[model samples]
Target: MSKVDADTQSKWDEQLDYKKLPDWKDCASILNKRCQYLEARDSKQIRSEQCVKTFNKNSSTKPTIVNPHRPQTSLAANQRSCILCRDLNHSITNCKKFLELSVMDRFWKTKKLGLCLNCLVKGHSVSRCPSSYKCKTCEQAHHSLLHRTQPADTNSGIDTPSDTSGQSTSAATHSAMEKEQVPEAQVILATALLLIKDSSEGFQLGRVLLDSGSQVNFINEKFANSLGLRKHRKNVDIVGIGVTETKIKYQTQSTIRSRYSNFEISLEFLVAPSITGYQPEASLNVSSWNLPSNLELADENFNQPSQIDLLLGAEAFFDLLESGQIKLGEGLPSLQQTALGWIVSGRYKSKYNTTKKASCVANTLEVGLDKYFEKFFEFEEIQGLRSIWSEEQNECEKHFIDTIKMLPSGRLMVQLPFKKHPSCLGGSYDIAFRRFLSLERRLSKNASIKSQYSDFLKEYERLGHMSLVPNPNLDEDHYYLLHQYVLRPDSVSTKLRVVFDASCCTSSQISLNGILMVGPTIQDELLIILLRFRLYRYALTADIVKMYRQFLVNPSDRKLQFILWRENEPTPIQTYQLNTLSSVFG
Candidate 1:
């Protein structure tokens, strides 16, 4: 009651009769209902007043009655205003002030106003702008006002004949003269020479860029390969300026250490084909400029253009900064102390008067609407219309037909259809050993699963489907398949199934399945098979046990299907070759 407003309380008190006062509980409920109604009424009145004020500000004339049926349209119209002039009378597209500005000036104004270049609107960035409007001049996603006209003779000068009339030549020369020229300034980016750990357990000097703006670190693919670092597969989309998109397939981890100091840190970086174009753009003459002699510079040749091998993101940037800093004269780069060394960055005036073009580089990631629609339509394609055989598939089938042989025991043996020679597969023993250790730990937790899995492998060996390698140290091209078991409690036949992973990648980042050609589908679809089963007068169904084991793999191909196994803890782990057809292959 004390919290209620005075006007509402007074109205409620007047409504009560002294001779016939209601019960205490009923009176409380009535008061609560009255307070709610009053609060809602006040909110509605405040909103209406705000709306009327907005309408009055946008409209120069007296307020007119807004039709209830079309209130939304009137409100939307009143809310519309010119982004450039902030005038409610017209939108930015129709604003005369915006159209009068020069092309370069319009671009700067749009950036300064924080308006979307695509739609010329505020509140959202160009990358996230929903409007699909494109420039009429170039059909780009930016507004027409931002499009720049190119000079005619820039690329077509050689195409013109020498016999052309002087008037035509003079017009071409005039167009080239009208082209804009801007002075070039040398800008130094923060870079350092750091030691990065390689696959051989040695450190190598690599050029690194320090960027506090990036959220994730990146490494150059060529540099990463030079270091011989093992990369793990990771699919990530990288977006850049103007919402341009790219993808990274691999990432690697390594330790970085300062060359002059003992400061060391480990980092994970996504591997990109290239971080960016060479830094500094061109060489700079530093004879006239003065720099501190006592400072240990991060990069000795910061003024020279060089490839960036790595980019340290914000996660490592802040930690490397120190309190020490030195500021030079105006139009000169300043020095900031860091873990690596003193980093020189900022603007630097050059003595050369040559004209050069400037460009902006930004890395961002975004999935556009077109990509989603493309993926959605991909699933809608008719699979039956697609060609069944390709060049590689035909070659694979021919190889199988030529190499296949029948054994004396009435079993067919076929060679694995490889896309390339098997020598490309590097060492896979370590990878397989780690996976086997992991499987052991998982099976240790469940005794019943462990027992069933061991029995299945023992049964497979008893059937002569696999055999132990005579010498595991044989110097030959080999691949190891990672094995695991799958459990099915409801199954009436086999309760456990041993599954081999042929897609496990080695140090070379190449898997056995990656090099092998997947044969075309020869089996009918399940729907067709079921429909045919119903048409028969009588149906008989049977499942073939160990169907894959019925066919044998060639002696040469068996080496590629090696596996690590042990029957129990007392037994030593031994390498075995699968002599029969593996389920991983069709």
Candidate 2:
């Protein structure tokens, strides 16, 4: 081993002097143990510092401990002195005066008492509390007594529990004093799982939320894209709680069907980037709650947090609701009968100190606007706006510049800009093979198309665009691209062309295009080019023959561009590595 650093040597010397070891062996053992202890202590200190920094970054205000050096107190001792009424006979839970306060008021009282939200115990915050017990209702890390509940009719807007009785004046005074101490309430929204028809007429199970407060129906943009539905451009502003606005740029129509009954409806939804964050926020235990055994739940996993794919607004909400309704209890979600099925909604009572209420509003707009402004200012220059590129796009451009080289034959050689190492690209040979078999079956029905495809491959091989793999066994970093043909019967130059599917998913459910960086557009738009052509006295148009083949890929990356093929059924399938850049690849 190398000699110890100065700091380490000094530490060892100090330990040895203090211990006064007799032999070198004893001194070494003691030094080793001391070093481990010091290392652990330093690591722990570093972790604590990191945690504090993270906490400070997330919290708007820092917590203040009035007496940090005070001796730790237990729950039994705290119970003797109620924070609400200072009663010596009973604890906060049993205190009659505390029970008289509203749920919102109780929440503020708990905050003021400086007790742990999870256990309502003194001496530690919720994060440091050793208790594993959580709120029975929401299963969140909070005491059940402090759990707040809102009305089931979330569409009517948030209704704060007010003490509107004889003590209204005093209640108002207390409310004003504890306005800042109020925490966001957490309430469960009505969600259901319904069958949504895709473009292919196939039905997919999607999680839909019933939001009567929203004037128009909304769908998650990513989910809408996955359905392959035709979208029409229709920009509109969606305003939600606190006048928060989000721009919806597209709208699509989809048919939804009930899983239990023959109920079906066609609905139009405005597409947004995201509907809302995950519902429930966290998972809940529903085993204890006695639900109706005869009723079939729309969403079986309503207790679990999940992505909301579609939101049915007021237009559809009222139409779907039936007259049937069942109340479970005062603190439990009530089952409401709808065309879709029985959906659980309403106030659930628990003892959590605070709950983060989930709303149909888009809360991320401010952060998005901040980022947009930051980018706008960053790219502003004397001449005009500089080219704006994301970090991924910039990295892609740099990768191309760094890895691109000119071969002896004057062909440009480049490496694939993979976001991750190639080893992580799981097995794709089976998928490619299956796709190839399907393509073969389709081609067999048309002899002319099959012959044309064979000729194209023959020409491709003749020109050295691709070569047979010497060994059929795939390497750890290998990938296979599924190949298909696109028929351009109207084209004079090429009637048939083979296209490689770079987006074909592997066993890992990730494709080459998914992990690869699609570099920014290097060519000008067609509209811009056409407009510039009009400015010239003479305009000429030409096409470069075999344009995609001009650029060659590096030898090391050839394995990742493998394809399977067989001219005839009698012959075994063969693997070929593409040597040149293809137009279809991202």
Best by TM-score: 2
Residues 1-586 of candidate 1 have per-residue lDDT tens digits of 3446787667667767666534456556767888688766766665565456546565677655432111123444456687677788656654556555445666788899998787666765665554445665567777765665543223322111111132232344333323332223567789898899876457899998898888889998878977767799999887776788778899999999998888999999999877876776766656545788888999989877899899998999999998998888877788999989999888766543222444334543345898666656554332331244556657877898899899898889988999978889988999899889999999999999999999998988999999888687546889999999877889999889998998888889899998997675567756657666656679898898889889999887899999999978778899999999977721
TM-score of 1: 0.38
Off by over 4 Å in 2: 1-386
Give each model's clash number: 2, 12
How does residue 167 of candidate 1 score in lDDT?
27
lDDT of each: 0.74, 0.73
Per-model TM-score versus the true fold: 0.38, 0.40
Q: Once model 1 is optimally superposed onto the true structure by TM-score, how far is the C-alpha of residue 519 displaced, in angstroms?
A: 6.1
Please, what are the lDDT tens digits per residue for candidate 2 over residues 1-586? 1156676666666555433323446546866877788766766675476456435465666543321111113333343566567776545554556555566566777788888787665656776555556665566787665555433322321122222142222344354334423433346789999999876567889999998887888888778877777799998987777887777789999999999988899999898877887877667656667887878898888888899999998988998899999888767778899988899887776443334455655634446777776756543312212265557778999999999998788789999998987777889988888889999999999999999999999988999999998686675688899888898989999999998888877888888888888676677655657666656679888899999888889998888889999999899999999999875743
RMSD of each: 22.0, 21.7
